[model samples]
Target chain A: MALFATCLTDTFYPDTARAVVRLLERLGCTVDFPLGQTCCGQMHFNTGYREQAKPLAQRYAGVFAGYHAVVVPSGSCAGMVREFHPGLVGASPATTMTYELTEFLVDVLGVTDVGAYFPHRVTYHPTCHSLRMLGVGDRPLTLLRAVRGLDLVELPFAETCCGFGGTFAVKNAETSTAMLADKMRCVLDTGAEVVTAGDNSCLMHIGGGLSRVRAGVRPVHLAEILASTEEEPWAAIR
Target chain B: MGSNPVTWLGTPPFPKAAHAALGDSQLRANLRKATGTIRAKRAEAVAELSDWERLRRAGEAIKDDVLSRLDTYLERLERAVTERGGVVHWARDAAEANDTVLRLTREAGADEVVKVKSMATQEIGLNEALAAGGVHAIETDLAELIVQLGHDRPSHILVPAIHRNRAEIRDIFRRQMPSAPPWLSDKPVALTEAARRHLRRKFLSAKVAISGANFAVADTGSIVVVESEGNGRMCLTLPRTLITVMGLEKIVPTWRDLEVFLQLLPRSSTAERMNPYTSVWTGVTPGDGPQRFHLVLLDNGRTNALADPVGRQALRCIRCSACLNVCPVYERTGGQAYGSVYPGPIGAILAPQLVGDMHDAQAASLPYASSLCGACYEVCPVRINIPEVLVHLRAQATAAKGSRGPEALGMAAAGWVFADPKRYEAAQRAGSLARFLARDGWITRLPFPGSRWTASRDVPAPPAESFRMWWRRTRG
Candidate 1:
């Protein structure tokens, strides 16, 4: 299996990427990181810079060509790879090989419980791309439900976008903030100690707001929580 | 005469308009309540029909069929309407459409006309044009009347005064409406009663009526007006002369096609099983209704829209405003920010294409207003790929700009770095230097464009080593 550690995870959330690798390897898979991997070009494609996105997409396809299965930690990047890659790089094996982390675990690995444990009251935000684009319905939730000692609370309006739409967060800051405020309010209402999502982009947006107000609700990647165990706690890594 | 252009003249770009709208706490609250309530009901309404997906597909197919053979269907409609004693006039643009209506009103020798809520007329600036031509167009729809009374532009497509709550509407009625009883209250029933009483006078006395059709069937030459109130029926039946200005895109091929739209529109727009009144008319009747009838088939940049294969799909819109109710941007900013009669996701695509000039700053700024959340597409009964069209329009707008200078150069430079692993690694190393600026592992603010991001939220600190670096060290 190949792991496409997205640009943000590679640069800022390396621990999350490491968690995915740890989780995957523990499940009896040899994880290969295509060193040549870079950005998914979602920012470029979404911002109407398709010409710039094209080459990056082609590079991505080239790097992960022979892998039978490619796993991605982030939902948006996985959606970009699965949904938009065909438009950028044309129909290819690479397009069909990509799977979001939860989808791979539930569908491919066929495992409800990966023998993980996370003792926290956490709410899961299903990012828009993961929910709508990938249609990764209940896979992440199913995985979370199985974690021993995990108290997974359902997020209110869980399917709505967190408004971290790539460049949209920066370009349309006020509206984005307004939406984030609503999402944060919902998270707070759940009274959960942590907020978790498949995509770090949304987590970053939600985390930023929570941290700013000192809300005491930490944002954790789903992979990190799923990678958690009685011996190696998820909290220790953060 | 007020010409057939949108009422919004000198409309600012989206960012400026949105900035003003965002500051309006009242407007935001109204939009949130209205949109949320409607959307919740719509979901329930849709879930009640198990074959909704089938209905949506059928609606989409019918519209696509109409668009593909629009010329054939339109000619068929003209013949049918003419046979039924209706005068079918063609307007190449808004100016022509306004001229047609003005001439018809003048022919009827009426200074004032009662109007049914029509987005087409609003799009063409008909009331403003009519007012300019020494004609008073009395808007009979409850929401339209509120907007007209307040001297404000119509905001939402279905509910023009959606930005105004009950209290504000009561104030508008108390201030602007002469017929408002002293005992009128801020409750919805009281507000609607005041409007009904006020419009009743205009309905009975007006010699001419002007409207926009919801669906104009090609086979029957029948024009349909689906409304919550019976205002549309009064405008159609009570007047001596009637004029309907309809977008060419509103045509569906056959009378049977009404089944799909009648089901889809009410459910999607108002979350109703069926609207309170749905009036359908073909041309003129001697003694039964209006003695004279005029149907203005309007182009007004629709031909320009139909010229592009991708953009033409937006014409499939049933004008349900389902997309608007589900859109986060519309909920936050309200409809006025869109600067056109059409607002929300549909407006974002339609306004730019209808304007057909990306250099026009107001139209161009619209395509970027959304977060590309895809909610609009999900709820769209006709399944118009609004997000797809938004990105497509963005590309067109970007191309029309010719050169973005620094932004273009920046993208190119970033593209270059991303193409090669070594260059990408080097760039990552350079970016990681920002760790020094982190306070407790989060960077709060930065320069220029990054400042835009940090203005509302903090960014995480770049890790000491990239993931690939960590991988190489451990694996080796």
Candidate 2:
């Protein structure tokens, strides 16, 4: 299987990509990182540049064509490749073979318990794309619950959007902030140490706000938590 | 009567208007409370049916059939209405519709007309037009009365005054309503009683009444208006001359088709099994209802929407406002910021298409108003894929701006970079230089376009080495 490290993860959140590699290897799967993959053109397609997105969609298909399976850690990126790619460049092997991390784990591998340990109070925020687009219901939570020591708490209004929305966070910054404020309040209300989600883009927005207010809460990726074990604990790099 | 001329004209683009609305804590609180309440109720109401999904499919299929052969259905409806002793008028746009209504009201020899709360009339700015022509159109619906009395634009579709709390409503009534008793309190029943007293005289005295149709049955030529308040029944029955301005898309093929919508609309909208009042009328009866009836069939940009294959689904909207209630953006910014009678996710897609002018900056901005959360799509009774239409309209808005715009240029540059792996890697390497700006591992400020992001949220500094660089170094 090949790893489709999305642009956002490849750049700012490289640890997440590395953790995916670690987790997959631990599960006895040989994960190949395709060097030619850059982006899935989600930012372009969603922000109204479909014409610009076409070439990138074609490029994504080209790079990941021969892989047995392509795993994307971000639900939105996987959703973009599967849902919009067909419309942009027609359906290709890349569109069909791609799976979000949780979907790949629970459905493809048939493994919910990855034999991981993360002893912390964690609340899972189901990102909009993951919840609605991919319909990845309870898969991530199912995985989180199986972790040796992780305490999974339910987030209030968990299905609601964290309002990152790629360019939407910047274009409609005020409304985006208002949405983020409610999200942060919900995260704070949960009294959990960390707020985790399947997508890094939403986490970035939520984390950015949590960091700004010095809320003392961490926004961690689901992959990073799953990658952690007793022998090799996942350290907070920052 | 007290509201200013209803016009979306001169309204700022969505971001600007939403910025102003976000500053109002009261509006935000009101919106959150009202929408939140309805959101839960709608869920419970919808859950009562086991075949809700199947019902949605049926509603979608029915509306799709209506939209596909709208001309035939409309002509059949016109014939049926005419046969039932109703005059039928076709309006190419808002001006024509407003003019026909004015002429019809004048011919009735009436200076005042009572109105059922109607989005079609609101869209055409009928009251303002009537007021200009020296006719008074009294809003009979409770929320409409509150909006009319307060001189306020409706911020919601089903609940126009959702932005106003009971206190604010009482204040508006006291300030603008002459019939409002001084002792009128902010209690819900008291407010309703005061409005009832105010509109009672108008219902009794007005010779003409105007309404917007929820559904127009092609086979029976019957118009349906579902409301919580019985005000719609009063407006439909009491007046001698009745004028109903209906959007061209509000047609159901047969009387049986209403069974699908009647089941879907009330549950999705007001969270009720059945609305309190559902007024359906054919044309006219001798002394039973209105002596004379006129049905103004309004095209008014609806055809522009119907032309687009993806956007035509917006026509399936029953004006339930379920999309508004579930929308995170609408819950925060309220409906006024949309600057259209249709607001929320539905408005974001519908307004831009209806306006059909992507060059209009305000209409162009509506497509970008949503976060593309897909919550609205999940809750829609007719299964309108609002997120799909929103993205499609965004493409139209971008294409209209041409290739020379800054955003377009940026997109082109990014596309060029992403199309080739080497260029993308080089760009990633260059992006790592931003690590110099990091404070405690986060970039708090950025320049130009990135500045928009950094204004409210902190961006993580690019890692010293990207994931590919690490992979090649360690594994290659």
Candidate 3:
């Protein structure tokens, strides 16, 4: 088993990568990090640079081909791998092998309770790609419900996009900001101290906004909360 | 149609228009309220149907079937219409459609015509064209009347004056509508009463009526106009001559096919259990309704759209406006920012393709206007893969521009680094040097092109070690 630490999770939020590894290993599965992994080329392909994305996508398929099962922490990248990669990489094993972390936990690993404890009122935002594109329905929630000492609260407009659409946040900054404002409002309404999601791209956008407003709410990746245990509690977000 | 001679407005690209629109707090508030209410209602209406996905698939299949063998159905439609005593006119473009309408209006010997709310007429700038040829086309729909009275372009497909509030409607009526009573109030009921009174005179006396149909049944040659108000009925019946400007893609092969559409449309659109009025007229019926009927079947850029395998799915649109209400982009910027009669998620895909010129800069900007949110696709009754088409169009727009661009160059360079493990690791190692830019572990600002990212939200700084680097050291 191998983990595809998506570009953002690898370079910026390696803590999420480590947490995923810890959680999977704790569930009695050996998780291997494929050294050749770099990116899924989602940014290039989505931004209309299809030609530029081809080699990277091919590289991804080549690197992960040997692994019978590939787990990804970010739902957006997992969706790109499982859904979009087939078209780019020509029906490779990676397409069928790839799994977003939550789906990997509940379906493949066949466990919802990972023996984790996070004593905080947390609201979960279903990232657009995870909700619509991947259709990993209630898997993340099922896991959250099983966590010891975790107070799971419902997010208003949970299905709406957080507007952290890779290049979209930059290309259309104002509209992105406007959408983020609505998402932030919903998060505030939940009265939850922590906001969690399957993708860090959404968390980064949301956490940045929360930090700016001096809002005390913390944005944690789903893996970190799941990795926390009574023996070794997860560290707070930087 | 591809081009609007009278109503083109030489509109600026999407970003510029959206920038201005974002500044208008009132417009934002109005748009937020309207789209929110409509989206909620649509969701509830759709949930009532246990077989919603089945109906959506049927709707898609029906439209796809029509598009695949369009000429056959269109010819059948023409034959059925002609046999029923309705004259059919074929329009290849906006100019042709306008010319046909103007000629028909002149032939009818009437300088004025009453109109039903129609996207086709709006697409062709029919009112401006008719006025240019010394004719007046009075808008009879309540929302259309508000837009006309305000001297404004429609900002929505279903509700043209959705950008304007009740107070603005009152102001427009007081200032522009000559028939408005002096003491007209801003209340919606009052506004509707005023419009009803104003348009009643036009409906009764006008010699001609012009409209766009929701569905044109090929089997019976019956045109359907589904509306909330009885204004569409008045427009279809009272006039001596009725001219319908229909898009070629509106055809449904059989009357039975209309069953799927009847179930899909009203639920997807006004979120009604059933529309208040549905006018189905086949042809001229002497003494019963208009004695003369002209059906102008329009093919403006539709063939061009159909030519692209990925893009032809856009033609499945029933003008339900469900996509608009769910789209975050349309919610923020409103319809005017799209710079075309079609706006929102569907507009982002349809306008560029309908314009059919990838080099057209204004149209090119439409594809990039969205954040590629799949809300539109989820809510669309016809299952038009809007984001898929948007990405497809973006590729075309990129191909036409031909790759000397900076974004293209940057992607190429990144692709190079990512294709090799050593190079990619080095790039990751190089990225960690950006710790200087990090303030409390987040980069708040950056240099040059990277500024686009940091302009709004803070970007994460590269961690101290790449995951590959950490993995190798720990596991080697």
Q: Give the number of the best model, judged by lDDT.
A: 2
Identify the leading candidate in terms of DockQ.
2
Evaluate fnat for each of the predicted models and list the values in order.
0.68, 0.80, 0.58
- Over A1-238, each residue of candidate 1 has an lDDT whose tens digit, in order, gives 8999998899889989999999998999999998989998988888778878888888888889999899999888999988888987896787799999999998999988998999999999998888888899888888899999989888898877787887778778888888899999999999999999999999999999888787989999999999999999986764
Candidate 1 residue-wise lDDT at B411: 73
Please write out the lDDT profile of model 2 over residues B1-476, one tens digit for every residue.
Answer: 11212238878999999988999989989998999999999999999999999999999999999999999999999999999999999998888988999999999999999999999999889998999899999999888888998888899999999999999999998888898888889999998888888889989999999999999999989999999889889989998999999999999999999999999999999999999999899988777999899999998789988999999999999999999999999999999999888889998988777777888888899999989999999999999999999999999999999999999999999988888878988999999999999988788899888888888888888988998999999886
What's the true lDDT of residue B66 in model 3? 96
List, residue by residue over B1-476, the lDDT tens digit for candidate 3: 23543125578878778888887999999999999999999999999999999999999999999999999999999999999999999999888999999999999999999999999988878898899999988999999988898888888989989999999889999998888888999988998888888888888899999999999999889999999999999999999999999999999999899899998999999999789999999987768999999999987788999999999999999999999999988988999888888989988898887778888878888888887769999999999999888888888888888878887788788888888889988888888999878887778888868786677667777888877788788885
* CAPRI quality band, candidate 3: medium
In order, how many clashes per candidate?
Answer: 6, 0, 0
**In order, what DockQ does each candidate have?**
0.77, 0.85, 0.70
Interface RMSD of predicted model 2 = 0.8
Candidate 1 wrong stretches, greater than 4 Å: A236-238, B1-4
**B-chain TM-score for every candidate:** 0.97, 0.98, 0.98
Task: Give the Å error, residue A217, model 3.
Answer: 2.5
The C-alpha RMSD of each candidate to the native structure, in angstroms, is 1.6, 1.8, 1.6
Query: How far in Å is the alpha carbon of B242 misplaced in model 1?
Result: 1.0
Tens-place lDDT digits, model 2, residues A127-184 = 9999999999999999999998898889999999988888899889989999999999
